[model samples]
Every structure is written in structure tokens, then in C-alpha cells.
Target chain A: MKSESRKEEIIRAASILFKEKGYSAVTMRDLAKAMGIKAASLYNHIDSKQEILSTIIIELAEEFTTGMNQIVNSKVDAIKKLENIIDLHIDVTLRNSDGLASLNNDWMHLEEKNLQYFEKMRQEYEENFRAIVKNGVDREEIKPFNIEIMVFSTLSTLRTLYLWYPKQKNIDAEILKHDMISVLLKGMV
Target chain B: MKSESRKEEIIRAASILFKEKGYSAVTMRDLAKAMGIKAASLYNHIDSKQEILSTIIIELAEEFTTGMNQIVNSKVDAIKKLENIIDLHIDVTLRNSDGLASLNNDWMHLEEKNLQYFEKMRQEYEENFRAIVKNGVDREEIKPFNIEIMVFSTLSTLRTLYLWYPKQKNIDAEILKHDMISVLLKGMV
Candidate 1:
């Protein structure tokens, strides 16, 4: 991996602050104070609060988009693709849940071009997910449940893991991955 | 069911406003204007913004508490109890998704005794769910996934149903109930 840049460091700190107080509530001064840097020094590394937010949200959205593209392009079947998607969510959540929080809550605050890009990525992600489910149904490899219901049932849990997983320090990561995939895909029956 | 009182009418309108604007952002003046009543008339039905929030959240929380009590005491097995709990959530969500939005997003804004009461009810609700899942695992009726994982996997979906179910007008309620229970409990594959 490449060495983290100064701007990346500023964005990372801003993501945490955004998670805590929400994007609208957080200011550059608070983020600077949290990083123990002078407020004016922050300007050298980042442009504005909006720039920090767009960076945090857009980067994460692109990361998810890239991951989804890989999984969709892979030779895996529908169930395998779904499992990989779940793993992708877990991997991202574990690495940058604070960033994921901003991605989840503050993406709407993104400016014009960034907002459109993020929304398009999101739309494509859902469509790719839907196609996988639809393929599974067509091939009779998966249950013919309502496509929307199945998608939301799984995605909602995966999406919200950032909020839930951080507090659950006791659950081992491997165990969490194993059990969450099991509970989500295979159900608990 | 009892007839809706004027106070209840005010509370219902306030819940819709709270859902749209969040609890803190909404004001008595906005609510009164929405109701086409003078602001003083709103005072006749409710005490303050705090009271409206408490009424919306506490009443919903207590309603959940009441339903959970019935399921917990029922003579059915753990799986059946879990099914009943799912039905309970759908019932409430269907009846009042708008109110549920406030219950979910604005519960933290509840104050003093109301806050304590809402938290207590919420804690008991989770504890009861945990116990039911634990019982299912012990009886070998449910898979031995991590109890917390199973509990969250199921409850998170149910709790957020209020948000998801409203937009899917093409899906019938009965079909939703059947497919949702199947997808949640029995897996997709």
C-alpha cells in the first residue's frame, strides 16, 4: 500500500468527527482540534468542510463500486457472489467504519458532481445486486423469493454493521464473518 | 379500538412532522400550521414540543413492550415466539410507519422520566429477544449461530421494515409477511 498522504490523514480525522456529530454539525475547527493541529494548519492539507466530506464519502463510494465490479466480473455463481459481497462489506466496515459512517449519513451532503457520481455508483451497486438475485432466481439456484425483499434483508444488515460492529469488541472477527455470513445467507433455521 | 381523541390527533400529526424534519428541527408552530389550528389550540392538546416527542416515542415504545410481553409469555416454542415478534413488528409498521420513524430516530430526544422509560423498555425488548434466541439454540430449534448475531440479524431487519416496506407498493402485505418470514428465518438458498 502507498504511504498515507497528509490530505488523506485530514480526511480520515474528519470522517471520525463526522461520524460522531454528523456532517452538518461538525466544523473544521473541531476536526482540527480533534487532530491536535492548529485550525489554520488544516487549510494547508484540506480545502473546506465540504471538501473533506466529499472526499470521505466519494472515496468510500468508489471503493465499494470497485469491489462490486470485481465481484460481478468474477466467475462466481450467484450465491458465491452474494457471499463475496457480504465479505466485501465486512472488510470495508472493519477497516474504515468511521468512513463508512460518513458514507452512509453524509453522502447526501456531497456537492454537485460528487453527489451525482456517488448516487450513480449507489444506483449501479443496487442494480448489480438485483441482477445477481434475479439470475439466481432464473437459474433456480436460489429461492424465488421477491427480489427486493431478499436484497434488502441482506443488505440492511451488512450496511448497518459499521454502527453495530464497533461496539461488539468481544465477537472475534473471523467468527463474526463466519457467523454473519451463515446467519445472513443460510439463515438461522 | 377507542375513538381518537383530539390530543391523539395532535400527536399523530406531530409524528408525521417529526418523521419528515426530525424531532429537534420541527416546531410547534409548524405542527399547528400543518393541522390548520392556531398555535394556542395545539397547546390545548399538548403541553410542549417535548411532550409531543415523548408522547410519540413513549407510546410507541410501550406498545412494543406490551406486544413483547404477550409473545414472551405465550406457550409456543422459541421459533413460534420469534415469528410472533416478526408479526408484531409488521403489524405496527403497517399501521403507523410515520409514527415508527419518530420512535426510531427521535427516541433519544425524549427527556427525563420519558427517556429513562423508553430506554428501559428498549433494553427489556432486546433482552427478551436474546433469551428467545438462546432458548431456540439450546433446544436445537434454531441454528447455533452466535446469539447476538442471530438476534441482530433478525431484529435489525424487522425494526427497519418500517422504512423499507412503505415504498414497495407493488408488494402485497400478506405476500410481504410470508416472504419476509421465509427469507429471514429459512434463508434464501
Candidate 2:
């Protein structure tokens, strides 16, 4: 395989391993074995297990940052912005469920520099999310509620969508998105 | 401390370490250091690190199981049953935020017997939760959307409430519970 795809393949294998055994428990040799490659050959592509974890988590975090940045800058109302945000989560999660798992579960194991960077991006993403919810409450587009509760309720459910995605694989994405929005945004009653 | 309170203190200290370093990463020595006690002394109250984890998680899981059983057997309507379910989660999470963290994040690290036990309880809890939702749909109490999505959204948010509870400590528990029930059970719109 070409170098680029070879690197992608290694990262993919590492994401799955990291998801299963977590970042700390999964070793470089284990990642290599999962990839059906020798440890020496694994080093030719990725520098260390830290690099694999950083790649999996930081990349996915940056994707969320990018998506949140878009949602924050959009010329849309609060509810519409949230719908767009849900779509962003669904799209990103469905495409990168394993990587998202690492991002959620193993992010605490990120090395020092990457940990700081991840913290900054995570705080900013949450701030952008809170800002949108605050706007919604101000404009009366959404129900008046505790902004933190609203944001937490929304983001926690959205962030952990990966945990449930594998089980719901057969369900169409669009239908899942609609059901989520309706239940989360609209309520069952 | 008395033996019972000492055990509670040990569990509390272990929970903080486990929350920060995860179950697999946390050692008995680390847990004892956090508690300002000797590792040998720590074993007097807890049998092992695994026992501490099992105490933290299995207790919380059983609390949830007991609460879920009550909800399942209640004579209330689906929405009321869900509200009770939400209250149960809020009450348990508020009281045992750290233990809840271990339950949500570290239960997978449980030893064989505990792992199987946790899985069994978790599956039964989800099944009972689903039965309530299914009954709601059949009785036309809840909106007929996807059952799994509705359950996932509700439970995921409920499960991760501990992650947000500490940050919102200034918020009153009653108000927090009210807002959560409103947003989650009644929908934001």
C-alpha cells in the first residue's frame, strides 16, 4: 500500500485497539499485531502509541471543533443551529465511530501537549455550544430553561452517540437524526 | 474513623483516583497515597483494588437496578414512570457523582464475575427501560418515534449526568432535577 493509505490503515487499526483496550492498556506491539505487521514496520509509519492516540483523539476533536465553528458562525436561529449541530454529530460519529470512541473514552490518556490542546478545543467547542443555547433562551426560540442543563442534556447525549451507533447500524441515519431531534428538541409529550 | 466510615473513606479516595486515572491505571498504592494511609492498612478495609472498584460500581449499579425495579413495577403512566426514572437518576447521581463516574466509565475493567454481573444488570435495566417506553408507545402516551433512539437519548444523558454534576454544584439539586425532567422528559420546545 502507498504511504498515505498505509498510515491510514495503521491509524484505523490503532483506533479499534484503543477503543477496546483504552489508550493506556493497548501497547505498540499490540497495535502492530492487530495490523498484521511487525512492530518495526509499525514504527516506520507511526512514531509511537502516543502518536496513534493523539492522531485518533486530536483529529476527531479537531473535526468537532471545525463542525462547532461552522455551527457557531452560521446565519441560523438557535433551534436550527441545534438541528445543524445534531446533523454534524450524526455525520461525524457515523463516519468515525471507533475514532469517536477513543476520543470519548481515552482522551484523558493524551500526552501533555496534546492533552492541553484537546482541553482548549473541548472548552471552546462547549463555549460555542453554550453560546448558541444562551441565544436560544434569549430569543425565546427554545424553551426557557437552565442554559447549562440544556447544553449538558444536548451535548452529553450527542457526544456519546458513538456508544449507541454500533447497535443502531441498520437504522437509516436520516431517520435516526430525526428521531433524536424530535425526542431531544421537541419532547415526547 | 470507625470501620464502616473508614471503608467509606477508602472507597471515596479510591473513586477520586479511579475517576482521574481510570480503574486499570489506578493501583492500590496510589489509592492509599491519596487517602494518606499505608497500602497494607488499606487492605484491612478493602480486600483489593478490584474490590474497591466493585464496591464503587456494583453498589451504584445495584442502586440503579433497585430504583429501576420500583419504576417498572409502579402503577403510574409511562410519563410518570419516566419522571420517576429521571428522578432516580438525578438522586443517585447527585449523591454518588464519583461512584457514578466509575460506574459509567470503568465498569468494563471489572473482574470476571463482577463484569458478568454488571453486564447482566445493565442489560436487564435497559430491557426494563425499553419496556416502559414500549408501553408508552402502545398506550399512545409517548410519541411514536423510534424506541431505541428515545431510550438511548434518555439513558445516555442520564448516565453521563455525573460528568456535568460537579461543575453545576452551585445549582440547587431540586432546581437541577426540575430542569432535567423538563428538558429530558417534556422536551425543550
Clashes of each: 0, 0
| Cα-based lDDT at residue B43, candidate 2 | 74
What iRMS does model 1 reach?
A: 0.7
Locate the minimum summed-lDDT window of 10 residues in model 2 chain A.
Answer: A162-171
Off by over 4 Å in 2: none
Of candidate 1 chain A, the 10-residue stretch with the lowest lDDT total is A1-10
Model 2, B38-145: lDDT tens per residue? 899987887988898999989998999999998898899999999999999989987889998898878888999999999999999999999999999999999999
Encode model 1's per-residue lDDT on A42-155: one tens digit a residue. Answer: 887767999888878888888999999999999988999998998899999999999999988888898999999999999999999999999999999889999999999998
Q: What is the TM-score of chain B in candidate 1?
A: 0.96
The lDDT of each candidate is 0.89, 0.88
User: What TM-score fits each model?
Assistant: 0.97, 0.92
